[model samples]
Target: MSQTVYQQHAYRSNQVPPQKPRPEKTLAQRLLSAGQRMLPWSRPTQTVSTRTAQVSPSQWQKMKTIAPNQECFWNEQTLEGLTGNIWARVYLIFSGLGKFVILYFTPIFIVTLLLTSLVTTGRFGLSDWIEALWAYFLYAIFPASIIWGQFEMYNRSYWKPKLLRKLLDAQKKFELNRRTGMVTLYKRGGKVRYSYPFVEFDCILATTPSQQGLVNYSLLLAHRYSGSMHGVPLGVLVTPHETVAEYYRLWNMIQCYMDVTQPLPDILLLEEARPKDPTTAAYDQQTGRNPRYWRDMSDDAYAEAITQIEAKQSKMSETGPEIDIFAKAS
Candidate 1:
């Protein structure tokens, strides 16, 4: 019994302790590791900077010929500020003049009436009949003259050069597609076509004093054509050819409204060249000079010719393609 009790006391107390569990990683940690492995293999992004290099005299002259489009937002911005302010000043001056014109005519007309009454009858009437007639004329002339003067002033002052600048500034910011460099003119049936390169304006200010909506429309189309406000006229007088031709495509667009049954045309891009009158000619005796026909060589054509000339010069200097010097002229 004693031997059996001693043998029963044996036990396995040397077993190993349980190991501590490792912490699991989160999704963020896994991603970070994966990113680290792939980053060195990825290609670096190539950014195209707008700041062109400081060019040489010849290169600078050449760059000017490129006609730096509306791509440089600053070009249009400069134009907007300059043109907008100029237009604002012009409009304000004309508006003030218009107001003064109204104020001046009223007194003048009253004086004319007094002179007429005095000339017709030498007697000064303190009678009720004279007083009633005078009151009636005053009442009738006040409202009617105001209405007429307002209409005339508005019609005369509406189409100043600043209006064109305002329109152009708006178009540059709102209408142009900066990526494609295309200007949207009109949209129909979900389809759109733009002017080729820069638009030309033609004779926007050709209108007389009474062409209200038509004049405004022409001014709008002028900016839509050029995307810049450089050549718009200060008054209803003729615009510079440089400004008009810049927006020629948009000028041609006025044809869409030429139909007889169409709505009253608000805008018309005129193409009529000013008649050559010997009476208006101012000559230069030094060179016996006359104004050149700008219509013969367009801005676009001139730009292309310059580009071609440069390309050929570059090619010849580098021993590359043999350019027919004459072929590039056109």
Candidate 2:
């Protein structure tokens, strides 16, 4: 057979085969990619884990007034429990003033400078205006800054005792377990400075009779700015309080409130209070230690133990002691 035209054309052509059409990007995918490109600095937001306050055994003993079994809670100190050194307090005072100026006054000063430049129109040069502004800030605003620090100190002193009194009065109502004593939270950035002081209370809420396990709840009495202000000498100051009864009220009146959502401490005491299974009870009676103490046992051993206990329970249920059923029936 002679070489056909088809074979000649195929041998002469060197063009590459077309690739499968690139898959079309979905709208969501395209938008997400665009957003990622636009926000180069953005990263996934992370939860900052806070370290709980650590109390020494002696400190704990000194802080706690009630016995281990009693439900009454008390923290002997007032809210000014975490008073730092004088130098530290001075640092905080200056820091707060600097923050206020940077955040609030800087913008106003900038706008004022711009307006003055526009209105004065060559009556003063930029240097002259800048000098005058510096003078005005130093002479006029500096005193105000000091006053601001003093006002904050005064507000803290005033509200702290009132808050403590409220807590003391509320404590008379229910049996509360002392969760923490005079905890001083440190601000982020690894600095050993006073952030705030708080005490936590844990209470076993009376659950409905139908419920099995005790309802563990906690209330955090912390000092934060209440956003309300009191008129002081120079200016109004922010009030700080626990805000417990304000947000949570009964019959339109302030009432003691407990937080329901915060993670409770591992309630070993409550677990001990719970009625144990017969097998576990027997084991506890023999060993005089909680059955939970054996949680480190091998998985196989644990499984075997549970199985044996269940089997014993089933056997007992099947052949348990009975009354005279036939006589009762007759």
- lDDT of candidate 2 over 124-186, digit per residue (tens): 687977797798679647765665654444334433345433332222211122122222333
After superposition on all CA atoms, what RMSD does each candidate show versus the true structure? 30.5, 32.5
lDDT of 2 at 42: 12
TM-score of 2: 0.21
Tens digit per residue, CA lDDT, model 1, 32-116: 3331111010111111111112123344334434432213222211111012334445545655565554577557756766776
Off by over 4 Å in 1: 1-105, 116-182, 187-330
TM-score for all models, in order of appearance: 0.22, 0.21
Best of the candidates, TM-score: 1
Off by over 4 Å in 2: 1-102, 147-330
What local lDDT score does residue 103 receive in model 2, on the 0 to 100 scale?
64
